[model samples]
Target chain A: MSEELDTGFFADWLRAAATAIDREAAHLTELDSPIGDADHGSNLQRGFTAVQTALAKEPQETPGALLLFTGRQLISTVGGASGPLYGTLLRRTGKALGDAAAVPLPELAAALRGAADAVAQLGGAAPGDATMLDALYPALDALDAGSAPGDAFPAAARAAAEGAEATVPMQARKGRASYLGERSVGHEDPGAASTALLFEALATAYGEGA
Target chain B: MAGGEQVGIVLVSHSSEVADSAAQLARELGGGEAAPVVGAGGAAGGGTGTSSERIAEAAHAVDSGAGVALLADLGSAVLTVKSLLAEGDQLPEPARLVDAPLVEGAIAAAVTASGGADLDAVAAAAEEAYQYRKV
Candidate 1:
């Protein structure tokens, strides 16, 4: 199989992400109820559903275009902190991808690194902040260490899942949960969980295709 | 007056009602000749959320050649505005995201803008509101 990713790969990746978010919506909301507003799942589901609909209605010819459109959709549709953070991730990564019709594994890794940095910059949250960065930074690190895109995704997904779990004991330093101070401890961060789901979807899509 | 025009203000919040109310309060506090105030809040369709598109639209609507000062409430509101600003081309020159308490910052910015203050002055006014003590 080719190691490069095309627009079709991104479309499938987004579809998989939508499905996974839908499936885990309730669990994500449950995770958020304690520390957050309990709307993470619904917000993501709504955003991803809009992304799915937009892709179906007018599909883009290039991966960058597809992801840019997806980011815009999420920014407009999703409410709360995740919308902008996730939107910035996809949009900045899409911008880094530029106009290339297909991107190789190494290029995609660089784009993901840029995306993770953009998310951190936008949210002002670093790794271990009990936020999405907790999961996203590790996923990016794993991807950076991998040899190829298709093979790297599973490892990245595993790292993201572990990173999300690691947030269970962290005190939030940003976002609404931070308002809770030390009380935010002991609850799994909803944003981190959703971010892990995003990596998992990527792994699932690439793994099945591979 | 820095550029012969009043600086504009955009109020961002997760709730549209809160944004509109804040804008109204700021306008009242600033009195007549208040710089144009735009409320960018909630989802585009409605309900609780912040929309970058809406914020951009508001920034454009209020741009009077002087620049804009954005006052945001909550985490997502700030993130969305910052992401929009990072995009570079979407906002006019001198557009700034003021890191301050939303209501107080909006009021202070509005009052400053109404006096034909420059973007920097309005942003500073908003930032100054951060130190407001309510005893």
Candidate 2:
């Protein structure tokens, strides 16, 4: 099988992301109900719908534009810590994409790394903060450590899932969950769960037995 | 308020789902005021997939005639917008971004933009809030 990251695939990736979030929005909200605002599902659903609308209307000329547009859509539509943190990650990563509509696997890995780094900086937290970084950071690290996308993606997904689950034992220190203190311990971090969903979407799209 | 004009708000986040939801909440919270929200973010992986191109794309989306305020989530993204401005990038004039607590900054910026405040003022408020959140 040929391995290439093209514009069509990139567009499909956004669609996949939207679909994944929509499918899991309810679950995310359910998790949040226990330890944070119970609006995770509603929040992500509305934001992705806006992204779908924005992308459909403008139809980016390049893959970079597609990613950038997606990022911008999230930033413009979403609020809360996830809004800015996620927005910053995409915006910075989109900026890194430049004019190339298609990228190699290595390049894609690098781009993912750039995005994860931006998000980490924005949150001011690390992998164990019971935040999305717990999932995202490990994924990037795996990719940076020379794992292939097919291999790296699933590994990242597993890592993310584990990371989200791990949040169950840890206290929150970032975002709204931080307000809950010890109460935040039992519940899975909503952002990490969402991050896991993102990886699952990608894994389904690109990491399926490649 | 220009007799009930629509305020163009720029939304920034990491994922499409999160950004979309945040924008919807903003609209719902905005009540009767019509808010035209725009969005941007890093790729889904959590870091910025690209930088200049995405900011430029978002900048083009802004309406120059209406007030536009940018709200972002993370540190580098704020820096990305700053870099875009520093480079004399091709973006709508009279636009600014808020680099503060993501939700608070966004709500404040949207409110100010919908009313009498210009994009600069809204952005300033958001930025100030962002600084406060860091501490």
Candidate 3:
């Protein structure tokens, strides 16, 4: 594949994300049932499906445009805090692309970093807080440390998975789970789990090849 | 900037009924339709969830150039309003997320805005409501 990614590549990744979210919606909801509102799965599934539908109707021309459009859809459709948080993630990353026709992998890396930072700032949490940052930060860290895109993606996916798993034992420090105090431990964070899924979807998208 | 014009109020809640009811009650206490008061509640498709789009729309609708003050209930409601504020240009210019209780804050904010208070004064009234003794 080319070093630079186009709108089609991201659209593919988002479609893969939607499918994966649908398949794993039950598990996501179950994870949330323990420490969250138990609506993460449904909300994300609905948001991604909306993205899929919108992408089909009016395909965005550039990578930034596609992500920006997707972000707005999620913000409008998903509802709840997840909507704004996820929307900001995509929109911030997309905005960093700056209407480039195709974005290089390095650019994507930087964008994801900015996106994660934006999420942290917006959510008022950090990597160990057991939010999506747990998965996202690790994935980006792995991506930055790797040499090849292929190796980086699988590594990132693995790192995200491990990060999500690590959250199981962490005491919640933010969001609704924090309200649970000590009881929040032992349950894997649903947002972290979903972040892992997002990385997995990215890996799958890259593996499909143009 | 304009103090003579009443500040607008937008009540955000997890449920449509909750926000509307608060707005209704606050209106009664606020001298009946003295200022623009809007209830932006629930997800876009209805049901549970705080819709940023809905809140933004409500804020814009109630805005009278005097500035809009937002009061939200519960977790996501506060987060959503903050997210909108961070996004820049989404909310009406000079909009503020007032830190206060949902019902009580809305009541105080509405009363203050209805009396033609400026945006800061309206927000202050809402925040001050938290200090009232319920017992």
Candidate 4:
């Protein structure tokens, strides 16, 4: 079994995250149907599916490569606003991982911060935009606040969930949902939902891998 | 039930490329050597692709008594699979519809399919394995 901090476990974590996305893709689409293109789930499903396929074929040698390849898959396979935003997040984080064979806690934290910043750069949205950034931003904030990796993950997960829920009342400021104006206010953001799942998978991984 | 013998897992997707991606994952995770994950997908339109029927026919032709699992992406691809299977007088194995996380479900299904288990078992595992968690 791989430890939470082990290089092997990072691969497992990415696979697990892929699984979670697969499971929730339709639900996310359902949430978006009312306010957006109704393809959020499908879009993400396709992207992550590509990531899984690519990773399986080549099997990245390092955690950084895993994140980089996964991010590239999303950018290529997925269309719409979510693709680039999510793509930048992973790519930037992968870049942050540098050339290290394995990442320590501090490096991982820095990578996450890099990911969050990249997301903001790509999406041009802040913490309250009811986008994936909403959940991801808070999660990174929580992570940066400094707790054990085990403790920080759960906190980040919780923050993400809250951020997703917070989208319920805010006006959409970006993405297809933004086109809806007030109509988008009541609907949950699909990107945010998937974002929440990423954190959730992370939280669960603390024990499974840790 | 594929006549209760060696079964092939059928994968359908909106595009041939997407379906192939699913096949790639299965090949990696499941089929080590002995068993292979059978795959099919529509090109562009759901029902138009010959790949879906050809793959199923190939599987049946190889071993008529074998069971084949059907996994469809969404849209008309499902109907195409149904028509192809109906012609063979072979009802699809307990099938799964995976729209979101398309790759994950396909990979999981392929892994289990090639793991030497029945279609029902593979589908169940694939479906259950997709649950999103918050830790």
Worst 10 residues of 4 chain B by lDDT: B43-52
Q: List clash counts for every candidate, in order.
A: 0, 64, 0, 6
Query: Best TM-score goes to which candidate?
Result: 3
User: Candidate 1's error at A188, in angstroms?
Assistant: 1.0
DockQ of candidate 1 against the true complex: 0.73
Candidate 4's displacement at residue A18, Å, is 1.5
If scored against the real structure, what TM-score would every candidate get? 0.94, 0.63, 0.94, 0.59
> Any residue pairs clashing in model 1, and if so which?
none
Provide the DockQ value for model 3. Answer: 0.69
Q: How close is chain A of candidate 4 to the true chain A, as a TM-score? A: 0.92
* Residue A55 displacement in candidate 4 (angstroms): 1.1
By summed lDDT, the worst window of 10 consecutive residues in model 3 chain A runs over A145-154
Q: Distance (Å) between predicted and true CA of B50, model 1? A: 1.4
Chain A TM-score for candidate 2 is 0.91
Tens-digit lDDT track for model 1 on A115-150?
A: 888788778888889998999889888998999876
Restricting to chain A, the TM-score for each candidate equals: 0.98, 0.91, 0.97, 0.92
The better-scoring model by lDDT among 1 and 4 is: 1
